[model samples]
Target: MRINVLQHTPNEGPGTIKRWAQQNHHDLYIYHPYQFGVLPTAEETDFLVVLGGPMSPNDSFAWIMKERQLIQTLMEQGKPIFGTCYGAQQIAKTLGYAVTKAPYKEVGWAPVYLQSTVIPGVPPQLMALHWHEEMFEIPREAERLFSSDLVKNQGFILNGNILGLQFHFEPEAEDIREIVINDAEYARHHNALQQSPEEILQMAIPPENRNVMFHLLDFITK
Candidate 1:
């Protein structure tokens, strides 16, 4: 399958997802739309994977709008799509949901209780990595799948073709360090839900989280 990756920033690439695609021998293409000001058409790839960034979907940037339009087109074509964090916010916005600031920023590792699992391979609960102050409402036609103690809408699935996750399941050890280091100032928020950069960097990534990620990839692509 030809999987197109839409990455928002240099620091926030596809991480382990890229490794999975490579190991699985699927053809993968990447677009840095924030830098290039261009995105791939739905016809160009079999599936779309949108990665996270520090930007908000509500921002009136040309690239952001273009990405949303691309998402809309992909949805109309019934292509499979997966989004994480900022990417998920874009999907929510495309589906007529509002993306707003949460009462607190959520950073570091936390448990996301599974509300329902239509995707088949995920577990009942996941200790996932989250690093966003923004939250999105569940889209009208989507099945709300996960919720966290801090965020009521942690994930959703639109039909069986689209999945949106507010947490990070694709980050490896170095990706975690880069994410924390690049967005260190966000960790300065005094909210109880926010974690210090040092704390974020030192936390041990649970093995089960990676297992969930692998299951999600297979569930989405296969």
Candidate 2:
């Protein structure tokens, strides 16, 4: 399968998604439409994975608009699509939902409660990495998958093939470090939900985090 990834920034790469692709022996391609202004067509992409970024879906950038168009095309074709963070917001916006400032700027490790047993083996509540100020509203006809105390719409699933998660599930240790270094101001913000760089880096990543991500990738594509 030709799995194409839409990466918005250098720091936010595919992380464990790339690993999953490699382990599963599927062809994976990562595209930076923000930098190169190029995106894969629906015909060329068997599956699409949109990674997180610092940008907002409300931004009037041409590339952001183009990315949304690609997402819409895939949705119309019933192609599987998965998005995280800003990517999730982009998907929601494309579906005619609002993407606005969240009640709180959730950063670092936080617990998200699973609203449904869509993904088996995943705990009802698990810690996931978050680094977004804006949140996507649950689109009509989409099932709410997860929620956090600070954000009600943490994740949504549509038509069993489209998934949008407002948190970072694919980032490994190095990816988290790069994110903290590139966006240091996020860690400096003192809040109950936010954590310092040291704390974010030092805390042990739950062993099930990677497995959960792998499960999600398999679930969306299968």
Candidate 3:
């Protein structure tokens, strides 16, 4: 199956999803709308994977609006979408969901409790790497999927074709390290707690999470 990847920045690639696509030999096309100011062509795709970035979904930048338009078009075609963090916010904004800040910021690995209907191969509950200060309100006609102790509404789904995840389930060892490198800044902005690489490694489930990632790819492409 062919997948179109909309990347927002140089640092945030598909991470674990990239490995899955490569190993499975699926055709993967990538776009950097943030850097190139290019928008997605009006075309149908089997699956659309929107990666995360540091930008807000409500940013007035031209490229940001163009990216949102692309996502809106993909939804119009009934194509499946899998979005992470900022990507999730894009899906929410396109579907008339509210992207707002919560009482507290969520960073690092927090426990996300899946509410039964989210049984798409991921466990009922798992610790997910969250690196966002913002949260999205569930969109209209979307199934509010998961919740966490910290974040009441963690994710939402739209007609089985679109899934928006507030948490990062695709973090690699190096990804963890990068966050640590900027931990001081994150701590200052949100008054967040610091987590070491060792602390994050303790909760790392790379092997198990890979299985879930493949399941998601199959789901979107199907």
Candidate 4:
């Protein structure tokens, strides 16, 4: 399988998802939409994985609109999309939902409760990792699949083909540290930051989070 990844920034690269792709023998072709301004045709990939970034969904940057169009087009073509944080907000805003400042930013690892009462064959509690200030308003016709105590709309299912995640289930422990370190502005705004690597790691991701992502992958592929 070939996965086309839309990377929005230099620091924020696809993390755990890359592991999944490699483990499953899926080739990943990444396009930095900010630099290239053009994404290769999605017809060549088995899945579309949109990585997270620090930018706001409403940013007037050229790539913002471009990626939106790309995601919209891919969805119309029935392409399976798995989006994280900013990528998820892009999907929501593109699909007519609002992405605004979350009531309170969730900067560290926060466990997200599954909204699906009876997960086909999985547990209901998942340790969802997060690092963002903006949250999407759950879209109409979209089922809220996961929620955190702070953010009720943590992840949503669209057409059972597209999955949008507000948290960072794909974070590579280091990514969590880098994001908090670099985004002191975000940290100050929410006063929701961890001061040290130890503090951040304490919010340690749940072991099953990766398994949950795999389940999502299995669902999307099926």
Candidate 3: lDDT of 50?
A: 87
Per-residue lDDT for 1-222 in model 3, tens only? Answer: 677789876666787888888887887788898888765575746678888888898789988887778888878888888998899989898878789986577766777887746446668876678777888898878877788877777887777778888888776777666655645356345534355445654665546666776776666566
> Model-by-model lDDT, in order?
0.86, 0.90, 0.76, 0.79
In model 4, what are the clashing residue pairs, if there are any?
A: none
Predicted candidate 1 versus true structure: per-residue lDDT over 1-222, tens digit per residue: 999999888778788888888889899999988888888887887999989988899999999998888899989988888999998999999988999998768887888988885877677887888888898899989989899997899999887879899989999899988888888887777645666889888888887777777777787667
Candidate 4: where are CA atoms >4 Å away? 117-119, 192-198
TM-score of each: 0.95, 0.97, 0.89, 0.89
- The per-prediction CA RMSD against the true structure, in angstroms, equals 1.3, 1.1, 2.2, 2.2
Order the candidate numbers by lDDT, best to worst.
Answer: 2, 1, 4, 3
Worst 10 residues of 1 by lDDT: 186-195
User: Candidate order by TM-score, highest to lowest?
Assistant: 2, 1, 4, 3
Which candidate has the highest lDDT of all?
2
What residue runs in model 2 are displaced by over 4 Å at the alpha carbon? 190-192
lDDT of 4 by residue, 39-139 (tens): 76757757888888878889999878877887888888988998899989999998988999987777766678888743376577777667787899888
What clash pairs does model 3 have?
none
